[model samples]
Target: MGTGTDTPHGARAHARAQHGTRTATMPVVPATDWPDPPCAAGHLVWAETVAGGGYTHRPVARGTEIRLTDLQGDACAHLLLHSQARPWERLNVADTVKVQWNAYLRTGRLLLSDQGRVLATLVADTTDGRHDTLCGTSTLVRNTRRYGDGAAHSATPAGRELLTLAALKNGLDARDLPPSLSFFQGVEVRSGDHGDGDGDGTLHFTGSAGPGGSVTLRAEQDLTVLIANVPHPLDPRPAYTSTPLEVLAWRAAPTRPGDPLWDATPEGHRAFLNTAELLAAKDPS
Candidate 1:
């Protein structure tokens, strides 16, 4: 991967970070659309194209493997995860950041819950690690100020609105909304002055997911997933524009201690243990 630079457009304050990859647990499905998926293995569960600015939601099994493809360059998928059995126990971005001790999520990073359970893992990111969790998603207020009020609900409503509706479909409401994990966007932090004036510290959306560039995840728990196919909060596009995203899911093989995600870290191991206990109690099996 190449380092990013600060320019008139949004970008990370620094250059690119070294990229990483991992094996997929499912077979690739070429017929389901988003041809030439990044993952070599994974059968298609179902595929959906979230129109730019539109939002969608779905329920996925614990062992399902997921792939998100940016059919066009520069797309954002603001995602949130929740336990299918317990809606309140959803993704905790703070826990994910603290447990990993890194703000940037890469392949092998665990997405944890507030109860310290593993939700999912970033098994692959084909955009050379250009995804971002820092810039977040755009909202009505934000879009109105940055673009205009009319731009708020055209196709890409604020992430909050989309997520709220997505969650409501799964028996959750606004208060249930959690901070999301952003993908297909990358940001760089910068300080000091640029040519015009004081630069201070700033994060620029310098990352872009080129065509066929993809990210894949393996769900460690049954997940109620919300997706916002909206522009990244920091996108510098001339207009409030976003591109469609193709989401693919497949059945996954049972994970063992030797699995990539299971052994990613000592904390991951313990987190899975907790998740297993919770699932077992729910199943009585």
Candidate 2:
């Protein structure tokens, strides 16, 4: 019933309204914008913060250092890795634990792929080596039971669902998803044979590394890294509580022949060799 003109009012009125809306829509930039500074000056390549219960995925080049920081200590950064060149060759948690002869991850440990190649190396850690590869990310059913709702857009989304979204964005699907590693949360193996005189151990969810804890890993191969910041499956808290996670990546040199981690173990040494062979054969740069 009104005029079909581009502006119902005059051009001046529309300009004034648009200016007011833009001013209100824009956020104010403060001096203390960055909570944490870069690890190294002038070398930061990428930085992002994944809100609690959020998911993110990115392709990282070889020789890059990726650091995941638990900004408030309650964040469980569920992580999955895939080789960029060969997506089929993804992280194998069981192989990583078996090949290293240690279940607990720490600095100098290597994250191995299913094809017996090194995907990433733990070059730095501030969380007392607290990490888990056994207990995978949270599921929709589990989160629904724990927090009432687990839809992708729900208040409490499951890590699996969130990661599925991330995977789909990267040209992958649910079938490509495997078990993931969780950083900032500690799961210990305790002897369940108390007074039973048996040799058995069970997983115990200890908790996260207090606030400000972080871990850094160096990519050994070009990797597609997927992360979901959510509550750990075994977290005992009754409330659905999680904190934000900060991710920072920078340019760095990959491991070389004289690097300590490369020769830290004969098994790891062989894994590094396998990684090098693949890179050399594929790129040879």
- Best candidate, lDDT-wise? 2
Task: Candidate 2: list runs displaced more than 4 Å.
Answer: 1-36, 192-199
Location of the lowest summed lDDT over 10 successive residues in candidate 1: 18-27
Candidate 1: C-alpha lDDT: 0.75
- Model 1 residue runs over 4 Å out of place are 1-43, 150-152, 191-201
Report the lDDT tens digits of candidate 2 across residue range 220-240: 999999999888998899888
TM-score of each: 0.79, 0.86
